[model samples]
Target: MLIETLKNRLVLACLILIGLYAVVSIGGTLFFQYEPNSQDLLQANTGPGAVHWLGTDYLGRDLLARIVYGIRISLTIAFFATLINITVGFLVGSVSGLLGGLADRLLIGMVDIFWCIPPFLIVVMLTVVLEPGIKNIFIALGLVLWIPTARMIRGEVRVIRNSPFIKFARLNGAGSFQIMARHILPNCIPVLLTTAAFSIPDAIMAEAFLSIVGLGVQAPNASLGVLISDGLQSFRVYPWQWFFPVLTLTMLVLCFNILGDALHEAYSSKAKGLLEHD
Candidate 1:
């Protein structure tokens, strides 16, 4: 029965894709001897061959090596930044939803300030004022991305904050923290997981966007965005440079999206079944 479901198929495919990416990101660094940055002018602009699975760039570096490193960087940023986003969003949303009234309005107003501000302007300012690096990119993205997350969680929590489960917890002498952490937060897990899964792709793309603009991972480092930017310069002569990185990035986003959808569907189905049984 599970195998026949579309959601199950998506979940299976998503897991396989995520597992393959995880191996490449982790194992590639230790096992792959190819130096992403060491360039040989003589071997520059070579097409994909037995020696180089992808090809050589204009600077004669291995495309496969660069891609491996790039994937690691994107995945790393996405993972950590999403963690930060979810953590902050969960706390803020929980408080706002559980404690209604003026406090909720004030917190929501603060979130609005963050949401209202222009993210691109902030990125540009950060890049110019400070040095362009991976850490800075992570910080910038984390700051901006959490706004939407907080709002989403706030909305979700509001819907269930007044439910019988919450009332029972409160009536049982549970303190505010106990009620929120034990009852409310646990109930919000499915929404949180789905939101987090979908946010991964956005975080990765944000890092890539910053890298493209010279504000993310420096020149010597290879990120998917950096590779794509480098490839654009020599696009007329070498198309492989752009194609491989873009393809990898696209697949990553697609897989995460699929996983998010699959998770949401599965959770919804399970919840429905439980309710029906009750």
Candidate 2:
């Protein structure tokens, strides 16, 4: 299954791009000459050059370094938020599907209530209520963005729970926990992966939006959104400040989007093949 998915050219390309971003973000300091926050007023607003690979921002901070560091911060926040989303969504969905009737209805109702509110709005409100910082943003995003994942997981769990194999397991005196842990959860891996792939870009974009509006990562700390916001101030004179970050963000999001689509297609085709064989 993994081999088949990797055979896709689009998926391979996306993976490579994402890998490059991760590597650069992780080891950027080794290659870059300047720290993200280190300022040199003499070099401020300069275009791309040998000294500043992607040029310097209004404060003369290295654009390339800031971008790489910003990518690290953005990816970090998105990764953690997605982690929380998966954990909470999986637990709620598994319990809801495994124990039906009142529990199912109540859980579904709660999900629906959250679903009705725009996720970004909920995140914004949460951020406002909490103090503005990276940790708060992570908490805000995680709390609000799990609705879609939970819904998808719930539906998948319900279907798996109704399968003949699950019924047979039950008849064999398997406990609910055993059925869920040993049987149902394994079958839901594809769904979880697909949902998680999609959820990452959403989390990245959400962090960016919050930073742009001044409700996210504060000054001196760079995020893609923070970079873009900073660039906007000097856009007319020095476009590199705005352009590089925007381009980076676009590529980052595009990579995730394509990867998610590819995973969805790969998983769907696999499932279809299995059904036809059966």
Tell me, by TM-score, which candidate is best: 2
**Cα lDDT computed for each candidate against the true fold:** 0.82, 0.88
For each candidate, what TM-score against the reference? 0.89, 0.96
Taking the tens digit of each residue's C-alpha lDDT, what string does model 1 give over 57-146?
998998998998899888888887788788888888888888979989999999998787787776667666767777767766666667
lDDT of 2 by residue, 1-278 (tens): 56787898888988999999999999988978689999999988889988788999878888999999999999999988988988889878888888889999999999999999998889999999997888888889989778888888888888778889989999999998898889977988888788778888998899989988999999878899999989988898888889999999999999998888888988889989988998
Q: Which candidate achieves the best lDDT against the true structure?
A: 2
lDDT of 2 at 134: 86
Q: Quote the lDDT for 226 in model 1.
A: 93
Candidate 1: stretches off by over 4 Å:
1-7, 126-130, 267-278
